[model samples]
Target chain A: MNPRLVFKAALVCLLLVLLAEGVLTLAKRHAPFFRLFQNQIVSCEILDDLAACSLKSGRPLIVVMGDSVVYGSDLHAHGVPHWREQALAAGLQRQLPQATVLDLSLDGALPGDYLGLYAAARRLKPDWIIFEYNYRMFSQKFGSPSEAVSRPWLRGLMSQPLFPALPQTAGDKIKSVLRKVSQLYRYAEAFRDAFFFPSREEVINRLLAQVLPSRSLRDPGDREMLLKLKIKPHYYTPLLTPEHAGLQAVQLLENELRRDQQPHLAFFTPQNQEYITEIADPHTWPRNLAILDSILGSLADQKRFFYWNWGALYPADAFYDHCHLVPRYNETFAKMLAGIIADGGRRDHVQRLE
Target chain B: MFNGWNENIRAFLLGLAFFLLLILILIFGQDLSSSKFIYVDF
Candidate 1:
């Protein structure tokens, strides 16, 4: 081949890559570009604090933080009433009409993210703080727990426990830089989410379910498939362990809350026990729940914070998956949470008067 | 040698065209009405 031809081919490939990157960046920036096919594109503004978004000055403020569970991934396809934050706010407003609720939860938010959210939220002097506890999130490992501890913002906030520290290598640093610079690298996950998995029918069905009150969000065929599948007994064993980084991260959050003299509520979000029981060994399933409940219960007790282990509150069908509650159940859960918060507030008021 | 070089150049051009076509399909085939925000799971 001629050297000129080789150079031309290389140049074409480079141009194509850059063009693809530009398209992806545009899709990310503008919602209309990605929404035509009924795809739910997630775009969030980067704000320093939750209060920065919008706040009612005189109302008592409540801030809740957690992962996708709290962010309401299952409800995204559904319309307004089904969103967890919206439902919860509506419920809370009914009970405490003057209070404001700020949901700081995002998808894939770990305890580390909560630590940052909490730090920022504290500046706003919220009346109450609620953190959603999902056992599945406990299995996540931090990249550099030691380095996180050393950071000035995280200093005195996060601490390393018995979990192994994953140091940031030179390769990791280079990859991080590349991920930031390369649009394809940055939006790879979004691309997969947009085109892959959850066939078009499934997405349509979810929307239909939201509109039609009688229709189930999950397809009967999908439910039948899930029923036939069995999960490994040891799947949750790593997360059940006491020394996992996730648990330690929660501990760090608890410590910081205590030091700051902040009163908070930590609730164990409902899990699909029926699915767990079917997939996991009978002996191991109960043990796993027991271990997790004990850890969280003990932490709440130690910190004098309100805790509710509502893991088994919902029926098996309420879950679209092993973890996320369907929109209807999410609304019910929010109402229950609002009731609990109201009750806690009343009890505190009575105690203070006494 | 000239014939072999010509074949190689043709093959390279064909491959490059295929690659560009794939990228174009991905860009144009994308659904644009999605209102969902990105959620990160721990």
Candidate 2:
């Protein structure tokens, strides 16, 4: 055989093998991809889905929607009893003694994200929703709250392609498609993790000893620097907004609740004494107070609404750092919530429907 | 009747064909496993 012919035949064989491999890989993961389908397909959604399914079928949800603080970082990841470490259901059982508490919080969520969730909750008909606004809630500082609307249906309309509020462009369509593809990858990753990888708690435990070394979270200056980088700390990005934007977020959320006639409780999570003192200069603290006051005033007559200012509740030692409540504080916070649910709100309806 | 142009062209084409064939083999041999390692502790 001529050398040329041999080379051509070899090349063709290689091409066939590559094509076959591609086809097989695509076929095997197709279903998983479709199930997950999002940008940078992350396992985050898979976990969210599993939790959502449980909430949907088992009982009325008591969602705790907010940012990373809700995920319980200050609490030791392994099994150390911390804020969210306690099974919310068990705690609710002790308090309400009848209803179940289903925490649907995801770390890194903002007010806008919470609004998205609130809209979903409306459809699900959750009995109670706690809109826990941590320090990051006012980070945006956008002024002038958006007009309140009665229909929760319109919340995501503007952000999604279906709404005319956002301009639909070719680039946007491409981005949307890419996001879907990424989501598929994420689903696959999550599925893979579910089977092969260690649970998040386990992994966090292993790394915690090494990464966090001291019980003390990184030095305050170090954390502040990291926050400025717009990296590890999820709050920094949102905090960059003008002060007014942040306040607007709270106002709009309140207005939204009023329009939907949904019952909600908003709490400003406890920050360590350091963060409080650092921000405590008479000006900033009062400004923050004003924002919270304004939000409460808007709902003044709606006796159903409640607010917990941890600033007055826990001591400085109760914090992991400037912003996060340490684990001990988490237990205290959980107990506080339980007490409030048990005694503060409407007594006749407390677990009455259940 | 000793022209090198034809010989060079033939050699180049042969090499190109071989390269393509090798790629095809790798692609076809790819694993279809949906399972992936999220993090591996060494």
Candidate 3:
């Protein structure tokens, strides 16, 4: 019960927490322990470096960016025929044999992140840039693009507006301090993810699913399984009004590309219509699509870039979930995209001749 | 008699115990269901 004993105990606890956090950080980077969860954990930095290297290769480079759909989450555990690799194998490379395709997509990436990525990627002078425009990200407001890659504490602090009108209560201020200072508090999500490791059977199933050709087939069971996954309906919320920050970021991205005379394509990626219809209110579904189309259409018209709304292009069977395409459809989607790009290039060439 | 030194020791012990309990809960009692890696919303 001595004060010195109490002080010693507190110091020991702090040191233990710090040591555990350090180990977790190292595991995140080097340890093979986390590789089992690769389906969920994406290394954005590695993807960025790969894209940058591809860009600098002096070949005509095509950079693709977006959220999980573009990250090919639906192709989880499947080793061969990744969307990017299939795009190349599906004659995308052969069509433009001198060009290279680099996918810079990551899970949860937004327009703000895309803006920052474009800024970084443009320096490498890619011939064409394609960004998947998921309507959901456009509806949500975003923090600063530059801070997206900063350290957790700095990112959380810098993401806040410089001059906030509302005064913070003492409790709010205390929580903020804890969030910034406590490694345990800041990396709670990471810890949770690490703790919930998938079983070996599940991991094996995912891997086998990747290799087995029948696994990609459009089964009636897919609908029930997808429904069981609890795909949230909130994503279909009709942004009756546009989010200014998102629009501005998209506008800025378009303006920069046009100024640099770079060819860019913004494609409205497909979503599972069956899932959307089942989950979303009938009125909200069409309204949301219209609102998204209007924004992308206006941007394309204003910036003189190509914007194609392919949201309903693929059937519900083409998707494993509400958003991502099944691995079987990757080649088809790639060929469709290549056709568009190739056709666009021929049209531009003809226009130049005129 | 509970003097100032005794009182300070009691408060310090209570604080230390509380923090240790919290750290233990975080380390062992994490919700396994809360580990979906991708944020579906954004």
Candidate 4:
């Protein structure tokens, strides 16, 4: 509480912090390559992968946007984890061969987050964009884009339409600005998750699984999980109201695409029909889907826009958990996507399967 | 009157502790503190 002591301590802390920041900046510059794990890629640092990725001739750039569905979440069930070589972008790469596929997806990405992601991705000048429309985005549990962490991702482009909600506080805006200023602040997690002990969580869980009882262990066999695992309450339960944030975010994205003439394919992300039909709320799921269809069906300007419902393409076994696919299925999904693109993503090529 | 460094090692230790704490938060704890509202079960 002494004024002299407080002043001295404050000055010392500031000087030390500045010194550490300088050291981190130097370390980053000399490091061969800074790799960001898929989970570590929060918000628009999706650009981190693109910046590190080897650029080809830049003929056809396919930009993928979605959540864990594209991230290959439960691929580990078959002794195969979400390795980029085995994931969707890799599959798409093999399918197209010449094209560059950028898979910019996080585990919990929502519809609101994509505006900033797309705004950031524009710098890459993508030729075709494939966005996965997960029905979970409609859940009220999540905030709209502008109100979320994406405020920083959008950067100076605040004047753009669709971002009506302001940040939670002035402190948030300042923190975001600071994040932009310091790479050390922004990518510290990327450094940890990528360089050191990437599997710290995995190792701990494995140890517990060995000593713990089967019931306590998180692992349930696939068949058992299929029978028991219920979809989280957030799935397909967006309240149908005048200010439905999820649907509104999608509409705003559609408006952006329409205005920019950005060729895009927005599809209903593939769902495990058997799991949904067996476990999830049957009435709410379909009802909300019908509501979604009506909204998309009514959206203006269909030119340069393609919406396909591939929701039921996979059966029970294709899924690892709720909505995530087993690794091999990612390759199969890639072929289907390749066919669509190879056929020029034509309206006739996209069939709406109920 | 500006003899604050008379505390010497105490001042240095306080500064060092604060630096490590800041660095730790910047790396692992940044996501925890900032995105508490954003749910990520992964």
Candidate 5:
């Protein structure tokens, strides 16, 4: 073995890898490209991204948190897909141009996610936290733990023990250290998908669309089928009591936020009331949110913590389906939220950033 | 021909190709999204 030749080759490879990582790191700073792969973000990986997130010091930061209702697909909209740009955060950004809006929401996210998200958002030092309080979260009928909550990283977040009793394996320790050191290794999926055309998902989806009947996960075109087959069973389940994992996670998130003196605003996720009544048993389902509403209402301090039931506020047309809002309605939703966050209930701060 | 400078350059190119291919496969081969995840399991 020639040590000199090996060293030269190793140095060349290292430089090439570093060069690639440098480009990805720089591209991740640009918000549009940065958010392109936001779906793949796990709880554990958020802090590093937030730490490197650059914002103008004077600009007030508003972190919007929730699930698909807060960040829905643009599959419904024709012409071209704008994805997150047409979602709630961008709508809020438009409404409150003075402040920077960070959409920390994801598809199928639950209350169990917010603890990890809030933990990550604290790094951003946000002025206001606006989130969707989806009533469906109260239903433990989904999965025992749910795939959303059982993500490898999220499994650990949910298992927050009083002591560091859990043992880490050799591989876990190495991965943890590597994640801390290398953004490339940590978000390799995001970087690769962003750089590749017709991404790996798109490729699989195109191929799968051939053999499988359903092509997309949240295809807006599938609403009629979703309503007939899936919606009733999913939404009409009995509300799990206070002991529900999601409710417990919500309580913990609220408690931590209060301890940190962080102000937050949450509205009962608005749905198409017309369609809801069709599936809902009237006493349960949608009423589950109302039940939770009274419970949350007991602790409501509008000055610091704002929670309201806004489920029936919008018309059927306002929603893309039964839950998510259309882009124009999203702007309306943003305006209403901005009014509260800017006014601070007492009109303490400027109503708008400019 | 085996002892020529061209052979050394060819070997370096071959090694670099193998390294890049390995990296590319590792990065893009797998689907991170859950296979059995149903969207309506709200």
Candidate 6:
């Protein structure tokens, strides 16, 4: 066969195979395999491109940086009391009475995403930036365990034969291409699942069935401590030990604050009410805050870093899960942050050399 | 050069076909509004 003929034949075969796969996927939209992929779509649609999508509105910004727990997983299911960005805005306005709030938080984000956030902060220049993280998120590889959860959809899509065959580009063009075909199957399967799979409420019921009892874990004080030196519940020894992720993130944040000349504050988000009680107990809580104290001490003795221990202020029911504060707490946290920003913050405490 | 150009052209055409399909879905398919993910807004 001539070279052109050979090329044409291969091209035709490739098209035939994709067409066959596409047809098979559509025809079996009711099948278990097809249905599984559709559920994956529902999850992916919820999870996709979070960093870009959350910031689409041009409101004032309050970026939440951390892991799955800080992403407001529980808050999403329960309505935001004031509504998320709205709640932050309200809290700030209630405090500053003149500020707006924007929320730019992606669940499962690691330190790498913070670098992006630092740039966004430089550009958008929000009144405040709230960095929240939990114990489980810190890890040696890829910075957090949320990567493990996010990887399945990403890995599934990437492993598809079509992903590698495409011309590589600066963006996720290949997934976007496959997503077109996948969405067709997604709708077909979602329809069938709607009929035979389950209603959205039923699916939620089934999902909640798997949420381990909140009481299965110990109370705040009794919960296992990950860091011996730190008084906090769980501390992953600085990613900067063999290498440092948090320090690098701090440098970026500091540079941004300096460049923008915007005041910033750092506060520990007490995940549970019990954590608050534990931190308040003079016997141990103050010791746990030693890490934070060191951080504050290093920063020119300025009180710009406001450490508000709300653990004692809120009760247990305020948290929906092990780590997430219910919407009311989110409001209170925002209100407190807004107050600090309105005060022109504590950097005033820093002594200046003439 | 001709063969390489031919391969490039073939891949581009195929990729373009997929891209067009996505545009159609975006225009016609059900709402992938993603606002429902409001649970954990970015």
Winner on TM-score between 2 and 5 is 5
Candidate 3 local lDDT, residue A176: 57
Model 4 ranges with Cα > 4 A deviation: A1-16, A19-32, A36-57, A143-163, A189-215, A221-230, A236-239, A297-303, A347-354, B1-14, B28-39
B8-42 per-residue lDDT for model 2 (tens digits): 55655665666555444322322223111222110
Error of 1 at B12 (Å): 31
Clashes of each: 22, 31, 1, 0, 0, 8
Report the lDDT tens digits of candidate 6 across residue range A205-255: 445556744532223442234212233323333322313344334444455
Give the poorly placed runs of model 6, Cα more than 4 Å off.
A1-71, A78-90, A93-97, A136-244, A273-289, A300-313, A346-354, B1-17, B20-42
What share of the reference contacts survives in each candidate?
Answer: 0.23, 0.09, 0.09, 0.35, 0.11, 0.03
Write one digit per residue (lDDT tens) for candidate 3, span B1-42: 556556556655666676667765654554323332223322
**Top TM-score: which candidate number?**
4
Ranking by lDDT: 4, 5, 3, 1, 2, 6
Compose the digit string of candidate 3's lDDT tens values, residues A1-354. Answer: 676767766776676677766775555454245434432333333334455556557676887777767666445423344444443233345556667765556555666556656665666577778888775564432323322321122223333332233355564465457654554654553444344332222443556668884873334476356444434444545454543455555666677777878788787788788777766657766776787677777767524377877777777788766677766566566666676676663223211000
Clashes of 4: 0
Candidates' RMSD to native: 9.8, 11.3, 9.7, 5.2, 5.8, 13.7
| Candidate with better TM-score, 3 vs 5 | 5
RMSD of 2: 11.3
Q: How accurate locally is residue A106 in candidate 6, as Cα lDDT from 0 to 100? A: 48
The reply for model 3, stretches above 4 Å from the true place, is A1-56, A77-97, A139-230, A302-304, A345-354, B1-42
Across A1-354, the per-residue lDDT of candidate 2 in tens digits comes to 577656665665555545645664465344344333211122233325534564656754565665445555334332345344443333444455455565545443446555555554555455667766655444432122332211121232233212235354564455345334443322333343443222333454446658777732244564456444432222332213233444544555667777777767776665555455544344455565565656655654536676655445556666555655555445556666766665544323322110
- How many angstroms is the interface RMSD of candidate 6? 11.6
What residue pairs are clashing in model 5?
A: none
TM-score of 4: 0.77
lDDT of 6 at A41: 31
Candidate 5 local Cα displacement, residue A174, angstroms: 5.3
Residue-level error in angstroms, candidate 4, position A36: 4.2
Q: For residues A1-354, what per-residue lDDT tens digits would candidate 5 score against the true structure?
A: 566666666666676668767876786555445555564554344544554553544688888887767766432233236756777888888888988787777555677677767766686778888868776666655334443352334334332521134455675566556555665665664444344322333445456667776655336556367545655665777765765666666677777778888888877788788778887667677467766787666556878987777777788888766787877777777777777787884433212221
Write the residue-wise lDDT of candidate 4 on B1-42 in tens digits.
545656755666677777778777765664444442223433
Answer with 2 or 5, whichever has the higher DockQ: 5
> Candidate 3 chain B TM?
0.56
